[model samples]
Target chain A: MNNNEKDKKSLIDDYKLHITILFISTISLGIGTINIPLINGFNLVLLPIMYSLFLAVLFYIYKPAKWINKSQSKTCAEILLILISPLIVKLAIASGENIDILFNVGPALLLKELGTVGTVIIGLPIALLLGFKREAIGMTSSICREPQLAVLIDKYGFDSDEVKGFFVVYLIGIVLGTIFISILTNILCYLVPLHPYSYALASGIGSTSMNVAAVSSLIALYPALSDKLLALSGLSNMISVVFSIYVYIFISLPLTEKLYEKFHKYFN
Target chain B: MEIDLSFKMVSEWIGILLIFSVMAAIGNYVGYQYPFVESLIGMFILCLISLVGLIVEKLLPFDNIPAIIYISLIGLFVALPWFPLADLIIYYTSKVDLISLTTVLLAYAGVAMGKDLGSFKKVGLRGIIVTFAVIFGTYLGSAVIAHIALAYTGMI
Candidate 1:
């Protein structure tokens, strides 16, 4: 995976397929932009990202035309980071313009990260209760997004139970996390009555799609607060992107290991 | 040997980013009603910053830091008030909506997922249940804390 041999080969051979994927993505952008108006002036904002994603999936899974092969999909996964760079840049620029938003949010930005501990506090216990072994630590220590998965794989080789556990949650995150978070964000926004800023901060749970979904929902609800919300969410996500690994390694992983020793017995 | 590989890699990245900017600009115009030319220009500048960040990541002795950090910092630096092109950068970039870029990223993500459907189907019910717990715990937990923190800070 580290070597660029496969990447280079795909770049050369599958250049046409890559363009086709981009073409399909453009169509998705058009369809995804549709927003249906519901009662009480609320818009049922259909997720454009969802459509693009599902379309790509259909192209892959449809038997008649196997549009993308394993190598090509692998290539797409590798370039995911590169594709995300522009969005990250956009977020950073948002943060720069609203530097005062950072100051205004103050310790909330730092303290809200503590909420990540909720992953272990809630997820680990349930995972253990469900009879997972050391795997619970891998699954629950963090959200197990790409970066956390990389860290876990480094600590425990890819063959380990921990990694198996990591992949379980990771795949679920990739497949369903965005949809779940978007729905949850909207429900919370409607029911909780919390400030849009808090929702924006919550949206930065260290995964790109999940974070994007959360913030998109917030912006849909609070168009007037779009800039500040984007700024806060971007900064919060940047904090997660930069610091999530250290938190997982130094704080979450170690603490989960300790708690596992004590909690595993009870679950059994 | 490494330098040659990286050079080739940069060109490939440019190709990919070019595809994203051009398509995303069209999407921005169609979906959000942003000006196509302005959005295209904005996306190109973003691609340039990302390229610079990738180069910096390769040049650095330490490998721990991700390119996103450098890319974001470069983005932030140029957007700072005193920077010469801050306004221009801010103006065009504002035309390129964040959500529009996400549609492209996730589309690729979905394509990547298609290859893994066989393995994805094998995940056990326990794992699925716990996946929900992890996602919910992280999001709602953070939201609750942010709620309290915001009230205390009087920002709400």
Candidate 2:
């Protein structure tokens, strides 16, 4: 083969890994949309799980591609977040006609319904009683999502104790939050009656991926309410991104610190 | 063949759409029960949206806002209930399932965690404890308010 043909062959080979992932992921997602009956009687659609396993399998057996590398994967995940962000807006825009869910008490309902405030109020004394360190309290009082990282860095400066504390929690959140948030929100959808749209908005408290997981799971359950769920979730996530950091750092952290001190002296 | 990298990227995107569209068709026959054409159409609109997103980034005075943010806001406006195209656009956009969009993304996230195992281990036991406490606290906090709200609304 000539040099040009040889170069083209090498390029095609390089593209093979990426092409495989895309095709498999699409097929897996398609399958995920269907329910398969198990021998034990429960029908399972395990598409998300299947898709994840596909990636995991590739990571273990195939050559690790750049897109799957830690840093590169971070970029890919962020791109996914940005891509989905618009869909949420579209959902809200469409649903807004039905009830203007974004403006019509959506924020109040999401906060009240999701109980973001209650997480701090009830958990503060308990965390103090558990003897959590001040750093831990700083992390705990906030949902400690990605936006908080920037505010924490700016306020405390990097290398401070609080930064380390935030890093510790942030790491754990990244590892665990991505998965459990979907399951937790799914359980909430089943156990509560606060409206699917409320849960859609509530899911926006963390990263876009988490929001997508929670919203998709709920959408899977309540297909009829899909539009409102999308709109409310999009709006709620934007609010969480814009405002939750300020609320958590300024108000929640100080309040938790004072409570921890009061309890430490008394209990210790 | 000294291939153009940008052209290669575009072809790759098209390849992805082709694969997804084919799978979606199979899904229709296999039991997914959604229209097969919708996935392809939805992706087409997404491509248009992304193109506008890039333009918005170039035109805007401020650089802080990300292109995705602008793209999404524009999407929101386009679908705004009163807009001329709102209803038509929402109908098309709504067809593609969120699960389809998130499934592969989550898969990539899983791969990322796999790739980052070393970083996670560095955090050690303290990270685990802090994470547990944070998760517990947040859930407990939300549960309390949820209970009262449900009670007040008589939803229970």
Identify the runs in model 2 with alpha carbons over 4 angstroms from their true place. A1-14, A30-50, A53-108, A117-268, B1-31, B111-114, B124-131, B144-156
- Cα RMSD, each candidate: 6.0, 10.3
For candidate 2, the TM-score is 0.53
Report how far off residue A111 is in candidate 1 (Å). 2.9
Error of 2 at A179 (Å): 11
Query: What is the DockQ for all candidates, taken in turn?
Result: 0.46, 0.22
List model 1 lDDT by residue over B43-92, tens digit each.
99999998898788777765566666687679888898888999999999
Error of 1 at B135 (Å): 3.8
Give per-residue CA lDDT, model 2, range B41-144, as digits (tens).
66566556655664556466664544444654566567666789777666766665545544444444344345445544665765665565565455444444
- TM-scores, one per candidate: 0.72, 0.53
How much is B10 displaced in model 2, in angstroms? 10
Report fnat in order of the candidates: 0.74, 0.30
Complex DockQ, candidate 1:
0.46
Count clashing residue pairs in model 1: 0
Please report, as a residue range, the 10-residue window in candidate 1 chain A with the lowest summed lDDT. A37-46
